[model samples]
Target: MKLLLYPNCSNGGVTAVIRSRANADKENTYLVVFTNDRGGRHSFDDLDNVTVRIVPDFRLGAFLTYLFNEYVFDSINVFSMPKIVEQMVQRDELAVTYEFHSSNMSIVEKEISQLPLDRVASLVVPSQEMKSKLSERLPKRLLPRLQVVPNLVDEFVFNTNGRSDRLSSLEEGLIPLVWIGRLEASKGAHFVPRVLAQLPENYVAIMIVSLESDPTRFDRFLAECDSMGVAHRCHILMDLQQQTVAEFYRSAAARGGWLISTSLMESFGYAVSEAISCGLRVAAFELPVWSRFEEEPKLVQVDAGSVVQMASAVAGKVS
Candidate 1:
């Protein structure tokens, strides 16, 4: 009944899974963080039955020490880390489950293909589209192990009462467009400038960049904004707590603004769901994964990679 949860970093979605499971089965769950990203550590601090372990270096010596001395986990749940799953498979006593969260399967395709599929208990995915994508990439023998488990957002994100104090400093009359994700090429951070350029001059993009994001790339994104003459319309925020993020969603909704997802791909749109839960409008690139939400009035889907179309959709939503 004991479970070990190993997430690559303290990502919001990954941490949500850890929190939900810990709350559900507090007595038998353990959380092991393998990176220096401490973004989601607060969520685990007060849990009575959850054991939290941190291995900052992730060096071979440190990993071996953790594996030999503290690795008595009966079952391991891995998130977005194939190498960890590979390591766990070597220990035949442990039942391993991989929770697939990324739409970009190329990164882990080789690792998954080479894995001991028979030893894996399940391959959990968040969306039917992801399940379908994995099906095409994986061997037919591994199809039976695929499980569809939707991503969970924090309950606080649904609350609409509070206002984000961080947004208070923003000038009046500007429409706030909230963007949440890493500042990476795959997530479409580089496209924001062009999208903003296409929007009304009063529109401002409030980007909540993930802690696991690359600093160099983010700086480059900002530089690109400057070059594009849209830097003034961009507001960058980072390392925010879940409750604070909810407030931002509420604030945006209250201001007649909406959330925007510029991701090239999404296995599951947690940010989009959270924005909708808070009664905010959303404009995102059309993806097969978001087909389920097509009927939702608050969601506006545009052609993928069409910056002009995305900008037009957001402008129309706010207008």
Candidate 2:
């Protein structure tokens, strides 16, 4: 089937999730991504059975590109746009599926509820927590349409031999704690310094790899780390390839080390899944879905907003 996947401006993990679907069942699928010019840059550039279209920003251009031509699509998969769903309905498209992330559900239900019911096929969410929230807020009319597809780990990520070989290269006598994500305000970079402060001297190094987005916030995080005197033990990695990311996970798993997620919000914890699947331990804020991990001995759960608690959790696991 021809699936037209409409990705709004922000494409991070969502693009990966979509690409995973396309890559999974590549033979029978024709995946077309309708993106604004700004959404063109992404890590999922090498994907096959996927065509990228940069729709124009102007009203006439948008209407002609997205609205008028949408009927050619057999199915429409939308991530983060109520207006696009409205336009799809206007064009008489039969099946349009909405993928929900933590940030967009409120706007989805609040603005797009009046659209013809059957045309909206299903709302795919990553976690039960998000599904619960969607179920609670969805107009009773749209409740039956929500579908939960748990976030999947990209199996291609784990190259066991490559990870094992990389693990051998690391310096001996130090247990590595690897973290990778964006360096931003909401990323809880502030909490990281505090988590490090409570660790014992023997816990060794933290390789905190992040894509540097805002310079001011990045500087603030480093400054706080310096003030805490834990800066010397933290290595800030800037932009590595996906295979290298998998290697980091492998190294940690080899050493029986843990991966930590301090962020306040995540629709689905990508690193948490990658780490746990690689057989490494995990620690995170007791957010809705993350709390579920604590039941597994491999994962350590910490109270949200408590650095000492997170550090203690990690320290206890590592020791």
Candidate 3:
């Protein structure tokens, strides 16, 4: 058996990885998720041949259950939890792999630096940018363990077609600019209204965000939109599935619109890539992770933190 342990399911990216791995090799894969409440919907709970164990409390008993289990796991892939890795290292029989998924390298470095590097079989990161960042912070000897494995978008994204009837409120001449992610400061979602304010009146901004337990932020975003006088042109769609999100991408593409990302940091631009796969144009900040896609005709890299530049790029894409 192969065990994949993540501290929580708060991150969709980690869940994506787990889903991909489970689908690829379901027979031997077992996912051990630490927490259940924080993140959006649990997307991997129904996979066949994959066992999902939710241990809310990360205590010694839980650790003992994993450590002294009858089912022997040949390899264990841990996602960004040094403490978990520390405990798993106690089991001499298991090969532990540390998978890094965040752009917050300082926090990651601080946590990982305390672990016994020699016991780790390998260190996996989602992108080359992450590999380089981790290399700078880690010991020279430990740098050899770093490996880059990019995230995979869900296969359903590629085959989805536009649903013209769904977004009926959008005017015929308007260009739909889609933004997907958590509506938080870190995600740069708060900057969306300012960007939308700069765009042409016909270029509407559609936000498909997870509004779970964060009503204040959502209300504040609406208030900001109203203050900026762009609330009328902005639409918020909540709790959409992967297929529905793909349809939005397709719908935007059909209308000659595109995806816009204002993320301050990204380990890998999964949503951006997915948008591109759906034949939609993308205007995103020129982050290190998107370097490979810079040459793609569908992807437009705007100056980081420049809302005007991002808005202008999206405006240019509008017919």
Candidate 4:
């Protein structure tokens, strides 16, 4: 049996990634754990081979002690979790793979530097972009143990020709712009309304984001939309399955729409990759991490930090 641990609710990409992995693994019985920091839905609770548990108390001691008493795990894989190495600092022959999912390398470096290296079997990152970032910040001795493992985006085998009710408000002939991520400045969601404002009125925006992830930012994003006079044109949708989102992306692509991103940085751009997987063109800032999709003709990268450049990339020759 393997153990997968994370500190977030079913908020965003990470939870979905775990669910995909759990569903694919038929050989191993896994225990998937999460914390109720934000208190939302469970994506893995219904899986047959996976046992879903939540730790209400987030302290490292409380978390470990509670799990230790209940069941035994063969190996443990942790996602962006803190201070667990310290708890097992004195243990011998432990099997632990610490996976860093954060967009910030400084945070990853600080946490790894504090860990007792002997307790950790290996360290894994989601992409080469992240591994490169970690190599720059982490100590020279720790470099050899670091490995790059790209994240998995769920594949859709079927297409939905029917339109979802959430998207019914969008009329025909409008260029439906799509954005997906948490409502955070890091994810570049704040840039959506401003970019929408710069574009022509014929372009309407549809945002798929987690409202519970950042309520303050969610409210601020909406206010910015209202301030920019694009709130009426901005449609925000939440709590959607990947298949439904794929259908929406497919529909958007059919109407000559593009999946647009304004994220400042991405460890790996799951939204963009998933959009491309769904056969939609993707537009994002020209960040190093986006180079993974360079071969994809559908992905057009605009100059970073320029709202006008982003607007013009999606909508040709706009004044």
Q: Which lDDT values do the candidates have, in the order given? A: 0.75, 0.65, 0.76, 0.76
Ranking by TM-score: 4, 3, 1, 2
lDDT, candidate 3, equals 0.76
Residues forming the 10-long window of minimal summed lDDT in candidate 2: 4-13
Clashing pairs in 3: none
Q: Rate residue 154 of model 2 by lDDT.
A: 70
lDDT by residue for model 4 (1-319), tens: 8888787765457787776676677688887777754433555546788877777544656767666667677888887665665675344544788888878666777777777665677888888988988888766887898999787776532233444344555676788899987787777877788888898897988888874744787788888898999999888888566656777888788778888988888888888887887677878888899887768888888887778888887886532
RMSD of every candidate to native, in Å, equals 2.9, 3.9, 2.8, 2.9
Candidate 4 root-mean-square deviation in Å: 2.9
| Tens digits of per-residue lDDT for model 1, 131-187 | 998898887988999989877655644566666555777778888999987777878
Candidate 2 yields a Cα-based lDDT of 0.65
Question: What TM-score does each of the candidates earn?
Answer: 0.87, 0.80, 0.88, 0.88
lDDT of 3 by residue, 1-319 (tens): 6677675564355766677666666566564555454443456656665666666654634754645576777777877677767777777877788888876666687768767788898999889998888888777988888999878776644445546345566778998889998876767887788998887788888898874675888888889999999999888887666667778888888888888899989888888988888888999877888887856999888888999888878878432
lDDT of 4: 0.76
lDDT of 3 at 148: 91
